[model samples]
Target chain A: MEAEAARPDRRAERAAARRRRDRRGFAIAAASTVLVIGGLTALILTSSGWPAVRETFFNATVFKESFPDVAKAFWLDIRVFLIVEVAVLALGLLVALIRTSRAAAMFPLRLLAILYADIFRGIPTILLVYLIGFGIPALANSDAEGSSTLSWLPTEPVVLGAIALTLSYGAYVSEVYRAGLRSVHPGQRDAALAIGLTERQAMRHVVIPQAVRNVGPPLLNDFISLQKDVALIAIIGVTGEAFQVAQIMASTDFNYTPLLCAAVLYMAVTIPLARMLDRWDRGRVR
Target chain B: MSGTPVIAIEGVTKAFGDRGVLRGIDLEIAEHEAVAVIGASGSGKSTLLRCVDLLIEIDDGDILLDGEVITDPAADPVAVRRRLGFVFQAYNLFPHLNVIDNVTLGITRAHGLGREDAREAARATLARFGLEGREEESPSNLSGGQQQRVAIARAFATRPRAMLLDEVTSALDPELVGEVLRAVRDLKQEGVTMLIATHEMGFAREVADKVGFLHEGRLVEVGPPEQVLEDPRDPETQRFLRRLLEAGRA
Candidate 1:
């Protein structure tokens, strides 16, 4: 007779052992994390400059005092960022389309687009900002001969800074868009055309939609960089943005806490976006 | 057989640089006839189909759709393609569009069917291909067989004069291949004229009214399925069939 009720099941016993092993693993991981992190904390706390560093860089008073002004200036940053982002997206797609088109009439424009992407993307973004912020106004206002050319150009540092950012980011984003366009299999174009869509309609409806989807993660990545690099405008003396305002407050009292406040503000927007990008990537991959 | 051929190719030639792909090929598909071109991987079967659809411009000669020469400089390729249905080997369904949109794009945009009518037409076509209730799903979310079925539905929705199938079953899994081929067989039941470039010898024997053997950019043999597959007169055709038998595909 098989007295199964009296016997211990092998599967049950194995599952119990697995549960024990998992618990032990988790405990070990927790212990190691505590030991390493606590050791580092103790060492940093014992450093000789800890007291002074805490007062200037991590002071609660300065952060509170500068938070309002930094937040106010961040609005300007937000406005510039939104405007520049829209301009960059449009400009990038235009350049990529011109470069990819086969029209003989587009030859000159295609050459100009190629050079624009190459030159703008090659230079550091801050250098472009500095040159445009100062050079354009100087050239437009007068010459050594006192004969001005293109005098209608805006002299505002903010406008010039926005333009510089758009040009630089547009170059990088255009390359991203071009790669997306090329990544589509040639068979796709054939199938689209075979369905009776005109070449223009094919690009607009079938080709571009898929191309944009293929490069979404990289495109968002470029926008994130564009967000953080908004601070570079401060180098051209656009002092209304958060980073510049924070720097001014920090310099007045020799307290670095206002800079920390600005960093936090930037992170507030960028970190959520970065997390969303990660999730979007996971969805696409799955 | 009594009227103009649905598609006629006369002395068609195409080349990519010094390498010629389709060299002086002539073929015809009469109304309601299914013509299967059997060939090795790069024997210009696909090139032939693409040339007929005007996806790839011919280097010489002319192709006629319903007795109208389409290769003339004045002929509009877009309008010509709108009158033909071409299915690719890779099932090139637009991944961004759902099944319904993929089917309706041609009907609405090219045929000028109203959106509501186009969608109803797409639904009916998809249902015929056993793809009903899959209208909202992305092509990427589907199996390879289901995707190819959707592609066929998309092409058939516009009700073109002839269907060009370039190895539609070649990219499918072995088990899934039967479903897509069954869909094609159903199209035959509707009396749709077809030109298929395929490697399935059994399918060619079952469905094609005539079989053409292509070898290195030329049609080496053309006859009834029995004469070509069973008793090919050309030595090249015999050798090709023997190779297939050795590989257990025949």
Candidate 2:
């Protein structure tokens, strides 16, 4: 009975079993991944059309020629994505707060917030980019001197495109924020109010901080989509971005390898971002 | 206990949809006195507390805090709440905040105390509740009893006019309930006016100046704890006590 306290666990056998279990888990994961992903990769690589597909999609000379320019242009995508993401975050939070506010004075603003979310979220992102990019300039040029719209209304495709991206994503991100705000138990908000915090104070300091914490995963998930959607700008004739440059290179040589190069560049940012989000999520759970 | 009432609930009627929760309930707590409301789970105990805090609106009737009709539609709920502290059963300390922040938030933000002064006051209150050096630890790190104590401290730190304890010890493990009850007893000894909703009949008998029993959304009985717990006139009150005693909870 005295020694039972000292030797509470079968430590040696348990440790060995734990190690064996971990190794078995890892082996199964690796085997299943190899069987599924690797099998698909190998099947495609060995197909009868593999030679032609390789020539068009995986030409090393084409990659070497296109990657440097595409990589350089990818910088534009990174910069715009960062700016748009931050802008969307701020705007989305504002809309969410406005929508969630209960003040009678904020009634009209609340309606506007709802309408803004609905309109922006309803339109396709590419269509929005096209409309804003082409429509604004077209309206401006139609002016007698093109002065007012030229002066204030952005004719630049990139600027217009960025604005469209911000609006479109802001709507979606605001809904995410709203869901986060709602996900927080009503008791927390009640507790905040019980302590004498005003409605605004409760939301800003207590509710918003907690809500933002709740939505971190979904927020990051949206940003990932936004990062890829930055390529939508290229469709509106924005030059010096990855996809457009890749498209130009591919057209010149009729080799699709440049497109693959662009895909790799997009993954370079997205994969690391996804990984960071995952790491943060894990750290939070621990 | 003084003659002046810190909180007075009069003819407070509340209904959710068509089902009534509090049907013309009336109770009062004098300054430095504790009144415990004991009843089964759906007996409107929490609803009474929430109505007094102005957390939920009553369809009819009024509540008075320090002789002012707070349930008047014109009254500011936030200002009314500012003077009273309501502790929830679940110990709703802000998970994102450390223990000290949970206490200091109301003091600094709502009470408008200076940050340093709030911290000093909060430290003293936390220490009084047996949580002195654990100020900066997150609420999640504390055990159930400790967390409830922090919730109590967070409410008490602001020096509220009246403290509302909503089954403060109900959420804790049976073994951990004593420490939280001890904290409430300390408040009672400190002469803090309190309106407590609780399941622990023993705690009520020990700390409360009076105990009220609720049955079917009605205040069926109210008197000194000894009178209410030992000999009750209402059938509902007697039946409730008999059930508790049968379950060995009394």
Candidate 3:
């Protein structure tokens, strides 16, 4: 309160105290991490099945051997992931736009978008994979009179799996997009419209950019989920993605080491994405 | 007030659900005239301005821009809005855009000017408003008064035929209100056709050629500022002014 207390050196003294407090906080965090890791290692080593468990799941030799095969198979998952993720983003945005359309002419499309989200979101992803993967092929082959109408559909298990994932995730991501769209203050769009931009032009330049920026974290979360769900294609029983290869190796060698490798691969991809999204969210807040 | 009417509102009615905000309002603004509508909060002054801009569609009657029925269902609201400028009470500058970009958006996107040319024009407009080196700064970073000035700059940059300012200074701090009112005063001096809604009685009296008093969604009285402010005939208008005087807001 006094002018004497507001001296320039007092500011530096307070800043130094703040730095010391931060250093203490960092020390506590490091100590806790070390303690937790130490406790986990001690528990794992002292377990009765430690040697056999290590051999079956954490075997260095088996890990090395399975790494190449699992890594190679993961590329297929990555391909499906990349393709489906892009398709999902586009489909989600389209569906979200349709659902939010205020025009009477778009009623049917809006209803269809609503229906797609409801049905696809309700159906389990694995079941969708089975139905599309096996059902479409069966339908195409069925010599029943008018069933050949489905012949143009891709019967390949991987492609069907991708389509199924696209539909399922598209439903989910559309909601994310919708929430983002709605999260933007109506005033922003009003300002754009007041300046004479058409609804679509305003949405494209102003609303969508802000909405997408707002939903960046959730979109990244969905992408990470999508990356992991690429393994779900293995449920179709044919495509040799990382999970399927891991399953095959586990069955053949009676060891789960290959599964561990696949798990590690997934974490490698997802953890970085999660971290990047967190950074982006924090940067925006800052 | 002289020349032909630039904006003509005829029996324009607007309602939100069952609550009518504007009750068959009729008003007209001549070219190069400055008309200020003053009233208590929720007196439909804002609704009137928004209706003219087509931001809020009127439920009944017609609005004309330069003698053409802009409220006719066939007219393109975007095209009509392109020819008119508006400043909101909240100074709704795009938070994602810097000051210059916010000012230039209308020219580049709506008026079909090239982006580079719009930017050049926006910079000059910002400079005219004493924001020369602040073009690249986001509006959120500016003070409330500066932000409102930028909003005014954005409205001015389009070279619109007429301008609508809806309670532009009502959201500002007491100290900041002067700068915004000064900008509006500057616009008035340039002979811009303006229909302004304000709670600032002194500014309205100084800047307005004509003043209208709105009460319960109806224009109770309208005339020259001297007549409306000094010699209001309606009891509601008298009571409104008396309340303002008691609050020391008049």
Candidate 4:
């Protein structure tokens, strides 16, 4: 009698399990269908018989002819990368210190840092670079004949690109630092206060070191993003670097191969750093 | 409450929003005296200890330390906090700092001690706490008991006149609690006045020179261990004591 009673219940349980499995299968099928459709759409759009794309992207002539100029462009990109990286780190740290300070005197400075970050981050980087490169010079040298602050700035495209990248990237980097500061345990600050360390002393000795360690992975990811964003400077007619070399080749040969090459170069720089960040994040979890 | 009370609380009340957490507490601890505050959760014992350390600002009244009004409206809170050390329940040692650096940080940074002198002081404190060979190890690498001891050492390294211990041993496991309590007991013997908010009835009964029972933000009873723990005068005190004993059994 007990076995007979349990049989229907077992049948119901089996039915529920079967239904769940069916639903899951349906969901997987729908997702795969969407993915396949999207992939096909992308392939069709990018591989449409555009002569520029076929000749410049696939043919070897454009690459060979532009190799030297592209090499110079890549070197310029490196210079921009180094300069922006260093500037962002230094300025970000400074902004973090200001934001964390308790002194009433620093309140205005903190407000200014916030304003700088918000304004720059909200606006397009190209606009800021254009303003700095073109607008600032125009404003500064309106009185002088063929002389401006742009003259004082390095004439080389590499130097111009570095300055533009630093100005835009530094603002964004400050927010990363602020997030790091917020991640530090409040108890750490209390511990420092309990020990009689002044606010500044505690921040320097206790808080910032731990915050930096905690935010390491995100900061590295940001660096990778910054690497890709460096290409934006090429829009300002700064050529002979990675992105610019591609642009020069694309314009001359009317093909997309150099652009593809630039994409590959970007992936090369970012992919390893991305993997390292993933490993770091996994280690933190463990 | 003789020999110039090291700490004097006169109608000290603390509140958050509309709720009164510490309702007009008046207490005193004589120099070198160990006072253990026993209470259930939300009794404001921790708040009172923080008030003494000036870690939490009081809403009303005064906290006098060394016979001076440390919590006076005009007094420098940072300066007052300098003379009072605090050990937290969670052992809030700087994770980035090694044992020695953790102990010597305040001495070197706040007290302006020479690095060598600060290190020597740190070494001596670590040795006192039986952490002689573990100076270079990060606090995270140490056991809970060792980390608490290091925290105690760091607190005592500055030679504060009084230390606020907020449920210091409450977070440790049963096996680990004794080691941390032992460190506190050692500090007591060495004349470090402490205001400890604790849940360990046995330790409170044994080591505390005076014990105060706090129930619902009020000090229901205050007396020596025997009077407060064994022979309570108040009904609330008896009930609290009973609950603690029953909980311990369970």
Number of backbone clashes in candidate 4? 6
Q: TM-score for the first chain of model 3?
A: 0.89
DockQ of predicted candidate 4: 0.74
The residue-by-residue lDDT of candidate 3 on B135-217, one tens digit each, is 99988889999999999999889889998999999899999999888888888888999999999999999999899999888
Q: After superposition, how far is residue B249 of candidate 4 from its true place, in Å?
A: 5.8
What DockQ, between 0 and 1, does each candidate earn? 0.84, 0.75, 0.79, 0.74
Winner on TM-score (1 vs 3): 1
Q: Which stretches of candidate 4 lie above 4 Å from their native place?
A: A1-55, A60-65, A96-103, A144-160, A254-256
Each model's TM-score for chain A is 0.92, 0.87, 0.89, 0.76
How should the candidates be ordered by TM-score, best one leading? 1, 3, 2, 4
Off by over 4 Å in 3: A1-37, A142-147
Error of 2 at A266 (Å): 0.8
Per model, kept true contacts as a fraction are 0.87, 0.84, 0.78, 0.87
The value of fnat for model 4 is: 0.87
Model 2, span B93-184: residue lDDT tens: 89999999999999989988999999999999999999989999999999999999999999988789999999898888999999999999
- What class would a CAPRI assessor give candidate 4's docking? medium
Q: Rank the candidates by DockQ, best first.
A: 1, 3, 2, 4
In angstroms, the error of model 4 at B245 is 1.7
Per-residue lDDT for A218-258 in model 1, tens only? 99998889999999999889977999999999899999999
Instruction: Give the per-prediction TM-score of chain B.
Output: 0.99, 0.98, 0.98, 0.97
Q: What number of clashing residue pairs does each candidate have, in the order they appear? A: 0, 0, 0, 6
Ten contiguous residues minimizing lDDT sum, candidate 4 chain B: B241-250
Look at candidate 1 and give me any clashing residue pairs.
Answer: none
Q: Is the docking of candidate 3 incorrect, acceptable, medium or high quality?
A: medium
